[model samples]
Target chain A: MELSVIGKYKLLVARLYGELDHHGAGEIREAIDRELMRRGVRNLAMDFTNMGFMDSSGLGLVMGRYKKVSAIGGRLIVCGMNNNIRRIFQMCGLQRIAIVADSLEEGMEELDK
Target chain B: MNKMRLEFLSRSDNERFARTVAAAFMLELDPTVEQLSEVKTAISEAVTNAVIHGYDGSEGIIVLEGTLDKNAVKFSVIDRGIGIRDIEKAREPLYSGKPEMERSGMGFTIMEAFMDSIEVESAPGKGTRVTMTKTVEAEDEG
Candidate 1:
């Protein structure tokens, strides 16, 4: 439920912590979108290192954000998910639309490449 | 074999609590981390459906019951809210009735994926009950 946005510019790195569920998804989405708008960031890099758990709601949040970022020709990078979280993403076929990175640094690096 | 039942107000906060309760109840089954995660995720989805879809934003009571038999855990989420009009359609992947809230419509899919079997029963003006069972095939290494 906790989110902090750091490293500005066109590519913004968003660090999310705690449980990622339906109740937390709304606030996270609004916060990230608000930051994206305020900074005019075209690319997004999400860090889920501290995320403890996520459900189907988490998948929807990612897909929705991907659609929003892609609409403007931007990309969303996801990284630092545990094995369980990664399995959920894979189950939802998210690899086709989003980039899974090994770390936040790698995700931010993708923005450069 | 053991059985436990809980009834709570249908609320988003209860989703996490429900998951925890299910996971705790399965501790006796000696589920692996993966099995526990899957069961917790499935419970979250089912309880969330009862709160979100069954009640349709209204306040209602969600009943969660868990039973442990051998290596399998069987649980059911029940709510007497505005029942789903179409059970088959509701079970479809990515067919959420509430799109405005950005619901992924993958609740059922997640339940099915994480559990061994799922049975949904509902009728208009009645209630919807989702029963699912998962067998902890892997024993947790002590």
Candidate 2:
């Protein structure tokens, strides 16, 4: 998987591409965490618009990041999930912990509120 | 029915390969996008279980088999590695055998949700086999 992280205004936006599975989660997690720590970013927004496939591992990645951000009084927003990904998120009850948005713009707006 | 089987090392990198092969094999069924995604997700979960829980970071082999019938598809992921002792507890949502790894423990739950039926057979010292099936609704031709 490929990931791009942009940090601004104390928020980090990660755009993930390709499939996310156990094989890729560890590296992605480390990369994101590095960015989060280096920039002292508070809130996080994950853009899944280009992600074509995900499984339970994706849930683990999101949950782990949520714990990290929330512990620091930051918010987590997951945006641009396809119907299939959304189903997995709902099945895992991810909506309970992370803010679900349709797009990155919407997620940023929610973080502002 | 058309059938195919693939055996690969239980490495983390092979997880995506296994699921993608399953999806390609199921194309014979001409499943809808949603149906394909569901089957792919289920395959991913089962293969991941074999890689992570079954082998436990050690190198082993994972066998993925796919069968396509008139309106349904079946898949089996098998591993000859350490198996779960308690199937019931393992199937529970949010129950990770390796919590330190930050696993969501939703593998079995996702498999059950996407597939029409799921069956798991394992012996603690023997191995584990997960079989899942999904029925595809035939779309009307225009």
Candidate 3:
């Protein structure tokens, strides 16, 4: 999967393109963590608009990232989930830990709150 | 009934390959987009379980067998690797044998949720086989 990370002020928006599977989550995790550790970057917004497929592995990726941001006293918002992804999130209870937004703007707004 | 079997290495890269092949095989059934997605997710979870837990970071072989009937599909992901010692415990949500690997441990749960029926058989040092079935009702056309 290809990932584009843009950090502005305290929020980092990482948009993922392609599938989020075990094969791809590792690289994506490292890339996102690298940006999360950057100075002054506190909140994280993961954009899934371009992501076509995801499985339980993606759940692990999101849960792990949530732990990281929580450790730093920051929060994580996941946006642009398709119906299939929404079902997975609901099944895995990811919505309880991370903010689930309908769009990137909504997620950023939540982060700002 | 139509049947196909695929054998591939337990490498992470083949995860997508396995999902795509399963999707293609179920096309003859004309599954709905949601059904297709659910089946793909179930297959991915089973295959990934074989790759990560079954092989445990070691290279092994995984066999995906698919069969199609009228409006129904069955898939079996077989792995000749280390088997789960406690089947009941492993099926629990958020139970990962390799937590350090960042596994959500929802693989079995996802497969069970997305499929109509699931059966698992394994013996330690022998192997494990996960069989799942899903029926896709034809959508009515106005």
Candidate 4:
């Protein structure tokens, strides 16, 4: 798994590459968490554009990060999800917890709110 | 119907390998991209469950057997690990036994959603077997 963390304004935009399965989830959690702590960033924006596949383990990664970010009064946003990933999110009822935006700009706007 | 069986170690990385195997098995049917993704996702979840939940941190053998009959495919993932005590509760949405591990507990939910039918059989001390089937409407079929 590859993670590119871009610091845009106050949001930490994390772009994930490769498939998001059990193996990828571990690496991503550690990398994202370390970056989040290093920058003291609260709001998180996850970009799944390059992600080709994702199982429920991807859901755990999102929910786990949501818990961490919300604990510190921050919000979590998601964007650029493919149909497969979006269906998983919808089936798991993640729309209530995480804001789904069409683009990175829209996700940043949601975080700003 | 053509059939094949595979046995491998219960490990996280094998999830992708297992999915690839399933996808290859469906190549003969010429499934649509969407149908192929659904089957691969279901297989991934089942294999992952065996590695994480069935074995419960120990190494074990996972048996993946699949068969293609016309336009439908049937497969089973068998693991001789710690079997679930409550099958019904386990099938519920967001009911993961390993909450601390950040498991969303949507494994069964996703499997059921993507496949046409799923049957889970298990005993507390024995093991668990997940058998699922999906029928694809080949684009070339009249």
Name the weakest run of 10 consecutive residues (lDDT summed) in model 1 chain A.
Answer: A1-10
lDDT of 2 by residue, B24-92 (tens): 998887888899899888998998888888999899999999898888888999999999899999999
Cα lDDT of model 2 overall?
0.89
Q: Model 2: runs farther than 4 Å from truth?
A: A1-8
> What's the TM-score of candidate 2 when only chain A is evaluated?
0.92
Residues B49-116 of candidate 3: C-alpha lDDT, one tens digit per residue: 89988998799999999999998999999999999999999999999998998999889998988999
Lowest summed lDDT across 10 adjacent residues in model 4 chain A is found at: A1-10
TM-scores of all candidate predictions against the true structure: 0.94, 0.96, 0.96, 0.95
Candidate 3 C-alpha lDDT tens digits along A34-110: 87776457778888999888998898999999999899888899999999998888987778888899998887776
Where is model 4 chain B poorest over a 10-residue stretch in terms of lDDT? B133-142
Displacement of residue A6 (Cα, Å) in model 3 is: 6.4
* Residue A15, model 3: Cα distance from true site in angstroms: 0.3
TM-score of 1: 0.94
Question: Candidate 1 lDDT, tens digit per residue, B8-92?
Answer: 9999999999999999999998888888888888999998888888998789999999999998899999999989899999999
Q: Would candidate 3 be rated incorrect, acceptable, medium or high by CAPRI criteria?
A: high
Better of 1 and 4 by lDDT: 4
Error of 2 at A107 (Å): 1.0
**Tens digit of per-residue lDDT, candidate 2, span A43-69:** 888889999999989999999999999
Give the CAPRI rating of model 4.
high
Q: Report fnat in order of the candidates.
A: 0.59, 0.92, 0.81, 0.73
